[model samples]
Target: MLYWLMKYVLLGPVLRLLWPTRVTGTENIPENGGAIIASNHLAVADSFFMPLHVRRMVTFPAKQEYFTEKGVKGRLKKWFFSGLGQIPIDRSGGSAAQAALDTAIRVLRDGHLLGIYPEGTRSPDGRLYKGKTGVARVALEADVPVVPVAMIGTDKVNPIGSKMWWPRRLEIRFGAPLDFSRYDGLVGDRFVERSIADEIMYSLMELSGQEYVDIYAARAKELAAADAAGVRPAVPAQPSAPVAGDAARVPESKAS
Candidate 1:
């Protein structure tokens, strides 16, 4: 009841008027039954927008912090997110990853659409980074079709560090479902898991048109912090002059 109330009475109407979203390829999503909607995380608004576009309720695993706030604001936040079908995930320590995967498997087993960001977190620079293997584990274990979804221009509408939203057009594209039947019954292997994750990320890169980075989110964050603290050396510059003919290609001998 609360979900419908918020979907229709609160967020739905407001979002329709405020941002005026356009969704393409929603038919790519199966009309009914269990499936995983794996997407690139560009903005926090993604959690809201994807659910708004889908016909059936799509549940996502939200970080536990969103539910564990203190005082009135915290209470309101928890109530709101809970009503929206978000499962609170304790994303701290080594066990958090396993917990989230376990929860996702449960959701899928219940025969529902599970929405997950393969990247694991919102991209700080709007570039699609390597996806965590958790997504692959859930899909393989659940044996559900994974649909690749791309949300364009949403990052601009609600960019990072911005408290307010900007009025802008948003596009949500859903690619055809990815089937992993070939791997069914295969013995669990880390290399196989990594390969499956890479395949999914490649499909997302094609759909999102964002530059792909090979680093995981946690490592990328560490690098970003180090650069901010001026501990990392500057990147080297490229040659200024042309090295070969009118085409300006470097000579084979000189390149070596």
Candidate 2:
């Protein structure tokens, strides 16, 4: 009820008027089944604009800090996100990471549209970054389709480090759902997971028309921050093998 009230009556109208997102390919979304909406992380506004344009409720894994903060403002943040059906997640690695993944699987199994940023964090620059394999693991475990979603122009509306929003042209594009049924029996294989993650990122790159950086977005941010501080950043270790295969062969989509 709260979600409906806020979306339709309270905030939706205002947001739609302010941003007026142009959406396409919503026909690709399944009417009643669970699926992962894998989107590129560009800005904070990606969360709000994506949900605003979609018909179904999108459950995203939010950083645990949002729900753990104190004071009236913190309380309000918790209330708003909770009411929007976001699941609190601990980004710290180890058991907490596994726990967050488990929660996401449960949501998918229960037949909900799960929204995830495969890049893990927003791009420090406006380019797309390499995706984490967590998305692939969850899709395999929960047995759901992965739909590539492109959120365009959100970075302008809510750029990084900007405290307020600006009215900007926004668009949300949904690509055709990707099926990984060919790799159905191989869940725990890291190579298979990496392949899937790369494929998702490839689709996002094509849809959003953003330059693809092979490095992780978080690491890129760290390196960028280090440069700004006049400090040298440590070189990241290379992966065991190159990231290539079917993902590379996937055809690019026509961006609007």
Candidate 2 positional error at 53, Å: 1.3
Q: What ranges in model 1 sit over 4 Å off?
A: 233-256
Candidate 1 backbone collisions, by pair? none
User: Whole-model lDDT for model 1 versus the true structure?
Assistant: 0.80
Error of 1 at 17 (Å): 1.1
Per-residue C-alpha lDDT of model 2 across residues 176-224, encoded as one tens digit per residue: 9999877777787776788889889888988898887778888888888
The C-alpha RMSD of each candidate to the native structure, in angstroms, is 8.6, 5.4
User: Worst lDDT window (10 residues) for model 2?
Assistant: 247-256
* Collision count for each candidate, in order: 0, 0
Off by over 4 Å in 2: 233-256
In angstroms, how far off is 108's CA in candidate 1?
0.5
**What TM-score against the true fold does each predicted structure earn?**
0.88, 0.91
Candidate 1 weakest lDDT stretch, 10 residues: 239-248
lDDT scores in order: 0.80, 0.85
State which candidate has the highest lDDT.
2
Write model 1 residue lDDT over 208-236, tens digit each, in one string.
87877777765666777788899974221
